[model samples]
Target: MATLLLTGASGLVGSRLLPRLVEAGHTVRALVRGDVTLPAGAAAVHGDLADPGSLRPAVKDVEAVVHLAALFRTTDEDAVWRANLDGTRNLLSAVQAYAPRARFVMTSTGNVYDADATRPARESDPCSPTQAYPASKVAAEALVRESGLTWSVLRLPFVYGEGDGHLASMPGLVSRFGLHPAHTYSVAHHRDVAQVVKMALAGTLDSRVVNVTDDAPITVLEMTALAGSEVEGSAEPLTDPWHGRMDGTLLRELGFSPEVPTVQAAARAGIL
Candidate 1:
């Protein structure tokens, strides 16, 4: 098993990924900005992606890196840019200095794809993100691409699972953002996300950009229902039909079939 280093150990996906890595018999070193309780069989290293000097200790001697850290919910665009873009550059620099040979797996978002796409966004799609979060992620992706390290960027769709608050907050977000009830989002489970991370580390996936999602896209109305809420009004005409729709064909072809294939299935599995 490989000795791996991971960032965002305290995050939702990272918290779940740690246990899976340990169960796979890998020696896991998790990086956090402060003290954090690590999953069993994993060691925690104090480090911050924004602080390049602190990242050295975390990257040393590790065989691979799965970077999951980012600021997602902040309204402050500058803070988001620094954490996502600058932090990624800092981490890549450390990787180049200490673990250049390590497979660097970056967890990106599907929102980085062009929001005005006429069809489901693919890996080859051009990016022109309007939001700060996805904009920062797109910038971060560029850094990873030019870093000269063995790398893979996983563009994940909206991920949900047990204890995930995203779905629960869907109602408020829909109204707040003026999203139509018909607005669709490609969704995935946390389990599937962890599975892909394992595959990325195993080198089963080729180094490049890959989109990860469940079998199909779900409407906002459907998602709201899953969250135990109702969409009160008819959907307005959408300007960007492909805002959240993503093609998961590539990930499925790569032998990653989700156990929870849809939002309906997720609800049945008690993950909604």
Candidate 2:
């Protein structure tokens, strides 16, 4: 079993990914900010993503690194940039210095490509990140692409299922805040994301940037309906919700298909 170095193991994706990695016969070395109790058979190393020099202890002697750490979002801009960009830099430099040959599997977001009107964004389309999170991720993706180490970038969309709590409240906000009517964005489930990560590390997926999404796409109204709520008004589809979707063909070729491909099934699985 290769010793897998996993960052953000306590996070939403990483938390779920650890057990699967262990079950697949890979030893997991999880880096955490504090003394985080890990899943059975996982090793914990105390470390910070924004601190590169302090990462030697965490990155050493690992066969591959699955980087999943990042600040999600906030009202503060400066802090957000530093957290996202600096953390990425620190992790890359530390891995380069400590384990250059380690396969770097980065979990990036589809937001790297600006929110689009076109349904089903492909891997070949251009990127224009309007938001800070995606912008920094784009920079990080570029860094990984240039580093020359064996790496794969999975541009994840709005991941759902696996007990995602936020989905319950989004539709309730449509009338509360009067959000501009926009088509619902594409969504990937938590399990599929973890499955593709393992695939990337196992070298089954060849694309550097795989658009990790489910096969079908849904609009905001459809998503709300699936979630058992109403948006209360007409959500003019500013862009083709389908264009924001990924073909999911690449992943399907490798046997990556979510049981719940649409919002209705996802919500039902979540018991909403």
Candidate 3:
């Protein structure tokens, strides 16, 4: 197994990923800003993404670096940009100085693609994100591509599982955004996401952007149902037909099929 350096180790996805990496016999050095319980067989390195100087120790001698740190929920655009874009640059700078030969796995959102996709978005699709979160990620992706390192970018769709409330909050998000219940989204379970990271670390994937999602697409109404809510009336047409759906053909081609193929499967497994 590889010696890995992981950022955002205390966050939802990273917390789940740490244990999986440990179980796989990989030595992981988790970067954290403060005190937290780390998985058994994982070491901790105190650092902040906003502080470049603090990241050196975490990056040193690691065979691969999985960067999962980013600001996903914030009203402040500057905060989002700083955390998503500038923070990535800072980490890359550390990687260049310390572990230049290490493989870099970036965690990016599928929202970076154009909103009005007719079919599921693919890695070759054009990017036209206008919002702060996705826009910042786009910029970060550019930085990673130009960083002179072996890199793989995983463009994730709506991820829900392992006690993450992302699926449960879907109904509220729909209400907040005034979205139609008929809107469908590509989704992936946290276990699948961890597997993707593990594969990236093992050098199974090439250096390219990959749309990572499950085989099936789930509707907003289904998500609401899974969240234990009831909705009434006919559904409205999707303004952006392919806003969330992403083609997982490349992911399957890479030989990593999802364990939980849909939100319903996740619910059945009690992970939602």
Give all candidate RMSDs, comma-separated: 1.4, 2.6, 1.2
TM agreement with the true structure for every prediction: 0.95, 0.88, 0.96
Which candidate comes out best when scored by lDDT?
Answer: 3
What tens digits encode model 1's per-residue C-alpha lDDT throughout 155-188?
9898888777878888888888877888889988
* Clashes within 3 Å, all models in order: 0, 12, 0
Show pairs that collide, candidate 1: none
Report every candidate's CA lDDT: 0.87, 0.75, 0.88
Ranking by TM-score: 3, 1, 2
* Candidate 2 residue runs with Cα over 4 Å from true position: 116-119, 172-182, 226-228, 235-243, 253-255, 267-272
TM-score of 3: 0.96
Query: lDDT per residue, candidate 3, 94-119, as tens digits?
Result: 99999999999999999998988888
Candidate 2 lDDT over 1-272, as tens digits, reads 67889987988778878888988889899988787888788998888887777799988877898988877657676666777778878888888888888889988887776465354667777888767787888888888888777888888877766666546555865666454345556777777778788889887764467888876666666666656775655635453344355656767777676756766676657633
Lowest lDDT 10-mer window, candidate 3?
A: 229-238
